[model samples]
Target: MKKIVSLYSVAILLIIGSCSTNPFTGKKTLALVSNDQLFPMAFQQYGQFLTENKVVVGTAEAKRVEKVGMKIKAAAERWLTANGQAAVLQGYQWEYKLVDNKEVNAWCMPGGKIVFYTGILPITNDEATMAAVMGHEVAHALASHGAQRMSAGMLQQAGAVAVSVGTQNQSAEKQQMWMQAFGLGSQFGVMLPFSRDHESEADMIGLTLMAVAGYDPKNAVIVWERMSAKGGGQAPPEFMSTHPSNETRIAKITSQIPAAKAEAAKFGVVFK
Candidate 1:
């Protein structure tokens, strides 16, 4: 009991001490891993990934990716400045690369390292649609989702340790059963919801970002519609999935468009 109490005390202190405010949402978020620690690792891994993959350059598609990525970056700067949160990006070193791959995906690592796979070009064909995707990916980094994920993983591990220690005196079979239950409960209840919330938050922030970058926020809906069509409705249920279902994402984006456009309008970007 004392061991479990100590474990819980440590976890609580870590959670309380390792939090940072999200600039976009003005929410306190977990940040057990700082950008100072996370960025160097992410940059190194990004460099390795680039060297291991075929990086497309000097092509129209590649140029487009760079172009749209810069626009998104600029939009982030503008929003952060306007909100008096520019210091949030002080340590960022932004780089955008287009990689030749068949997987329809794009991602932005911590500290603004971004990659676009050629396969996703079909879905993000035009500048506006591309902006939509870029904004979403960039928002993930801007909101520090990666750091939050790592922090959450740490807490999950701590919880597992607590469970193990608490059950050390139990029969082996009962211990195994308890551990299994904790695994399922933590994953489905805590981790999945945490990830889905990040996705939804990114969608909201990304919509505003694209709009601020002079892209129609409504096109964000179209981009996801294409994504849904591409996936052919072959996704796990929302509760079990790391990302929200396509239908759920679309509905949320649609509902958020008005607010996004209003946000853009503040920066003299108006959409018809």
Candidate 2:
């Protein structure tokens, strides 16, 4: 009992000690690895990914990707500066690439390295919807969601360690079984929910960002609607997935459109 209590107490302290505030969200989040440590790694990985993939350059769609990505980055800068938080992006080396793949996916690495898969372009369909998607990816970087996820993973490992230590007195078979159960419980119950929260946060931030970047926040809802309509097959239930369901995402983004417009209004940006 005492060992378990001590282990949990240490885990709590470690989590608290490793937190840093995300300027975009104005929320304290895990920061076990600082940008100082994470960016170089992310940049290198991005370079390797580009080298291994077919990077579509010197094309109209590629140019569109670059143009919209830069605008979204600038919008983030404007918002950060307006809020007196510009320094939060001091270390970001923003790079955008459109990769020729059919994965229907996009991501923003730490320090603002972004990639858009060509497969998703069909779903994006137009420049406005593209900005909505770009904004979401950029928001992931600005919010340090990757770092938060890594930090959460570290805490999950620490909890596993605690469970292991606390159960050391049990038989080996029982111990292994408990560890397996703990792994599943933590992944499904804790980690998946954490990832879904990040996704939702990115969705909200992205809506505001696209609106401030002169894209109608309403297009964000339209983008998701298209994403849903384009039969990507079924996804696991939200409770078992790293992302909220398409329906859930569309609903959440729709509800936040008014708030996003209000935020854009602060920057003297409005939609018709």
Candidate 3:
């Protein structure tokens, strides 16, 4: 009993000591891993991935990716500066690449390394839609979702350890049952919901960034609509998945457009 109490006390101290505020949301977030430690590793891995993959260069499509990415990056800067949070982007080294893979995905790594797979271009169809995707990916990096995820994983592991120690005296069968229940409960109840919240936050931030960059925020909804149709009704339930359902995403984005446009108007961008 004392050992379990000590373990939990340590976990609580760790959580309290390892938190940072999210500049965009002004919310306290876990920061067990700092950007100082995470960015160099991310840059190295990004370099390695680029070397291993077929990176399309000098093509119109590739240039388009770079162009859109730069616009989004600038938009982030503008928003941060306007909000007096320009320091939030310090130490970020932004790079964008288009990979010739057939996966309909794009992602931004820590410190602004970004990749757009060729497979998603068809759905993007135009610069506006592409900006929507780019903005979303960029928002993930800016919001430090990667760092938060790592921190969350560390806490989950700590919880598993606590569970194990708390059940050490139980019978082997009962111990296994307890561990299984912990796994299911933590994954379904905690981790998946945490990820979904990140996705929704990114959606809102990305919409504002794209709007400020002079892209129509409404295209964000359109992009998701196309994405939903492309999925062909195959996504798992929202509670079981890391992303909100497409219908949820579309509705949420639609509702947030007015606010995004208002934000963009601060930078003299007006949408009709």
Give all candidates' CA lDDT scores. Answer: 0.94, 0.90, 0.93
| Alpha-carbon TM-score of each model against the true structure | 0.98, 0.97, 0.98
TM-score of 3: 0.98
Error of 3 at 32 (Å): 0.5
Clashes of each: 0, 0, 0
Between candidates 1 and 2, which one is better according to lDDT?
A: 1
Candidate 3, residues 1-272, lDDT tens digits: the string is: 46667898999999999999988899999999999999999999999999999999999999999999999999999999989999999889999899999999999899999999999999887889999999999999989999999999998999889888988998999989988998999999999999999999999999999999999999999899999999999999899999999999999999999999999999999989
| lDDT (tens digit, per residue) of candidate 1 on 24-46 | 99999999999999999999999
Better of 1 and 2 by TM-score: 1
Give the poorly placed runs of model 3, Cα more than 4 Å off: none
Q: Quote the positional error of residue 172 for candidate 2 in Å.
A: 1.8
lDDT by residue for model 2 (1-272), tens: 46767988988888889888878778888888788888999999999998899999999889999999999998899999999998888799998899999998999999999999999999887889999999999999999998889888888888888888888999999889878998999999999999999999999999989988999989888888888887575777789999999999988998999999999999999777
